[model samples]
Target: MWESKVNIYNVFELRSRTLCYFGVGAINKIKDIASALKKEGRKKIIVVTDEVVYKVTGAWDVIEPALKENGIEWVMYTGVQPNPTVEQIDEATKMGKEIGAEAVIGIGGGSPIDTAKGVAILLEYTDKNATELYEQTFIPERAKPVIAINTTHGTGTEVDRFAVASILTKEYKPALAYDCIYPVYAIDDPALMVSLPHNQTKFTSIDAVNHVTEAATTLAASPYSILLARETIRLISRYLPEALAHPDNLVARYYLLYASTIAGISFDNGLLHYTHALEHPLSAVKPELPHGLGLAMLLPAVVKHIYPAVPEVLADIYEPIVPGLKGIPGEAEKIASGIEKWLFNLGITEKLSDFGFTKNDIPKLVELATTTPSLDLLLSLAPVKATKEVIREIYEDSLNPMS
Candidate 1:
């Protein structure tokens, strides 16, 4: 739990509504969960997923049999693309409406889970569309129950009260955080993640890295967040390479999955700052840019700038990954360089230029970062002031690969 805002009495709130089950064979509980839903009159569910992930992970094998035994049916919507768009949400919402799907089951990573969150909102507010939902024409208080069966060790959308989707026409990506959107149940069965490809395994875990780093240092940070954030980085630093090397290593997958989940929880309580605020616009403009990769490119630059304000927390969080890194004043550049070199070693060597961004693109990126609907809230949480010039410099600093 976390306080909604900083107060004078060192007060904070730590409330998580979702009941999450983490371990191997965790997916086996789907039958019992589905049976309960059926008894509650939610006989049909809307399953949102991408084409490749649901099939590749074989999660459907468990889900299908369980639902059939319980006489529960599902309508599958597999149209979610990376950086999931409003159009995709609308399409899935339409499918869910057609079946009157009472519950939402998101079976992949962030993209599908995000779609499910949108579908749940639109399903409840039949008159509202994706654009209106993003615009907050009506702040949502409730939606159909969502069950997130995670297939990747990233985004933690399953366990957190956050969802993001883009408006293709506007190139606007907005984050949704409401109590109603937290999934009713979350299953983090690392068993499904073992078949994940090497690059995704790297990228997704890096997403978790970005999560804990921001959560531990954001202005809203609390001791609860800091403790879990430290452990998250420690686990990722130790287990990510092993998971990358032995894709079938269940133990490695289990720890990495655990790290991602806790990272999600850390940010859920602590909130986030600059990296996420800026990365959304990058991926929104270029749909093919993966969210984790975008965050990876911006993380070091953000660290360099924000370190002066919260050096101690940043140093401790990053020490496992970048040993001997310190929190000294004016050491921002050295720390930034160290972080860039570390990410470079982790295979995220591409500059913004590699993604077709340039000095000319910086202005547009800044405009989007500042003016987009929900981004300002995140920028406000930065330990350092996230002025336009600072945003510009961070983008500029990321343009060339670290030497």
Candidate 2:
């Protein structure tokens, strides 16, 4: 099977150079690191986060005192939101520059962390501000030191150098641009995830599952990517339900969080497939639906949409991660059906109607989805090439889902 394949440039390559520090039950390392940073005469650290997280999680209380104790002046810009925008980046960058912050700390989920990355990019590179960063201009190499303290176990934004933000002016969808925006420090403490709401936990786990599944099937996927993706899928399949059922089980949460990080690394090294490509526009247009819910609602159909293009590859991958479908046909149609059935068993529904998306919205959504920047990248990886009409058909199919 590997004999006839020939490759031209190493276009589907994944590379990152960052020091990784991993351990079990190390949530409080953020404080210890902060104290060390302060002792080293690092002052004027800016913490970019959201108001709810800063107050509710008491992240500000722990990190703030640590910085203050070392005589480091600190400031905060907590206005970042879900699917962060360029305006927020501009505002935060200006604030960071004004305060002369030598370092930046992100203390929440993907949103605030991603927002901090965007701000850091603007601060280091573009003088035209955040709006210009979206225009595809020259990017700088150096950014202020960024410390990512991940409170959410899902988005592995801490390790990756890419920061995605939704720019409404650019068609009201998420725009992904990469730069040297990696965090100087990454702190992953599952303890922070202890207080997470049950729904949020389940939903975010679904998002991580989407990451692994999509990467396992996309164009940039490799043997390493496939292996990592499969392991992540298996771990999630085994651990997500357990974590959901026993929310306080440290062992389950630890594995789930570990799975989430691995999934993030996999997708960051690989690339997201159709589901992530489709969900961005829906979130851009809807904004009411949580990102995880949007993914859960759309992932099954997206899987079906791409399955016909690469059935055998997908079936072989799924055989190990998902049980009960091992003996089925490996053709595209049966593979798609098997994946659909598995998703249904996993309690993920296919209907957009359940989430309030109507038939009337299909055309616009199709147009939006087909035009999304991620579409070409995702489609190139798919087993099948999806045209506008095919995209429309998928959207229509998503309207009435399996009841």
| lDDT of candidate 2 over 1-403, digit per residue (tens) | 2112323343666655444445454645666777767767677877899888766655565667667667778778989887787788888888888888778888888889888887777667646676666544555577777788776667778777767667677545544536477787887766667677777787788788788778766767666566666677777778877777887777777877787788777777777756776777777776666777778776656666666554444555566444444323344445445555655665665467877788888777877776755455665666457676766666666666533
- After superposing candidate 1 on the true structure, give the runs of residues whose Cα lies further than 4 Å from its correct spot: 1-8
Q: Estimate each model's TM-score.
A: 0.97, 0.87
Q: What are the runs in model 2 whose C-alpha is more than 4 Å off?
A: 1-16, 20-24, 35-42, 137-140, 169-171, 177-179, 324-350, 373-375
Most accurate candidate by TM-score: 1
- All candidates: CA RMSD (Å): 2.5, 3.1
Candidate 1 minimal-lDDT segment of 10 residues: 1-10
Q: Give the RMSD in angstroms, all C-alphas superposed, for model 1.
A: 2.5
Q: Give a tens-digit lDDT track for model 1, residues 287-362.
A: 9998989988888888888888777777788888777765665778777888888788778798799989999999
> lDDT (CA) for every model shown?
0.89, 0.69
